[model samples]
Target: NIINARLRGKPGLFRVALNGERIAAIVPQTDVVAPAKGNDLDAGQNLVVAPFVEPHIHLDATLTAGEPKWNMSGTLFEGIERWSERKEITTHDDIKTRAKKTIGMLVDHGIQHVRTHVDVTDPKLTALKAMVEVRDEVRELIDLQIVAFPQEGIESYANGRALMTEAVAIGADVVGGIPHFENTRDQGVSSVKFLMDLAERTGCLVDVHCDETDDPQSRFLEVLAEEARVRGMGARVTASHTVAMGSYDNAY
Candidate 1:
């Protein structure tokens, strides 16, 4: 129970009740209430509300803005290049320590849920494995969803499809793809279809970097939408960083 909590759209201090981890009720404190005792806390008229959610983040690549070199151009490709160089020196403890420290900061700000994209392009699957362990280590603090993301082109990288399949097989909760980076349009469409089919087979959620590009001709998002519609997986689908839609000839 929390006494003297100031909730939004309400007048005066309110007594907030809790059942386990959830808020049970809230009653106005019209009269002077005694100081909280036992497990209860006194809010001291401070605003009290629900926890926050971090919808999308790259926890695998956190706290490494400039390791070997800086992204002076600040382009997505340049950032990816920096990450590739950093991946060479990535260790399991390194990933977990950085991820845990970052999560601690996020939890301090009231975030209780997070979805992170872990790059799975490495042949050894180092980051994906480390993130899986971190997910279990911090289960009590927050709900962590790890995405098996292919930062490099799925069809362009060596044994790319196989690496993605192995990542999901290990412990990835969501299947991810970056279709716009493929060498050709046909390859992009093929990559999207392969990932959707893999998600359907594995019963995992789908979150694709559908068109992370500015080319107006990039149309991989259409393939993703069609696959989701055909598979009846709309609710389980997420398209992230789809910048190409903004460059379409007639678009919103």
Candidate 2:
């Protein structure tokens, strides 16, 4: 029940209401309000605003800054190499421990949604399994989306195709690929086709690490966009780290 309706001028100054939730019925001179329940805010100095949203993050790779060695080159490839070495040492417990820590940080920052990629090329599938468990563990506080990423390369890595399929079977929400790292252009194109087909088969979203290089010749993003258009999976697909787009000269 609203007790006092106060208007200071001809139009309005400030109006306050109290029902299930207290709200400002009219605009206030200052962007401040009295504190309410559940807020750890000071009485009259706090301001009530909408909740926050953080859409993208890699929970699995986060917080593993340096283990065996550090990324000396400061390049993405160096980071991948460091991660690959680290992945070899990753146990289920290690992934879970780091993922939980990362999620805790996200919650503290008021982030409610996240999209993380788990490397599926590892035969053990430790990272994928751990993230799936973490998703359940933090469901009350955060929404998690896990992508089964063939980080090494779908065809280039041994049994990568099977690993990706198994990841999807085990509840990965998205299928991923790295086309530029494939052995040849044909392999790159085929990987995208294969990933799209897998997404169709498993009903998962598609995200690709495409053309993340400084070379002007990288054109897999066009291929990905074309395939997405043909398959009618436009926004369902996300092409990440297309830094090569800054150098491409040709259209198509």
Put down candidate 1 lDDT per residue, 51-170, tens digits, no spaces.
899988999999999997999999988999999999999999999999999999999999999999999999999999999999999999999998999999789999999999999999
Give per-residue CA lDDT, model 2, range 53-132, as digits (tens).
Answer: 65456677888888778898899889989999988888888888888888888777767878888889898888898999
| TM-scores for every predicted model | 0.95, 0.82
Instruction: Flag regions of model 2 displaced more than 4 Å.
Output: 1-49, 250-252
Score residue 215 of candidate 2 by CA lDDT. Answer: 79
Per-residue error at 97 for model 1, in Å? 1.0
Residue 182, candidate 1: alpha-carbon lDDT: 82
Best by lDDT: 1
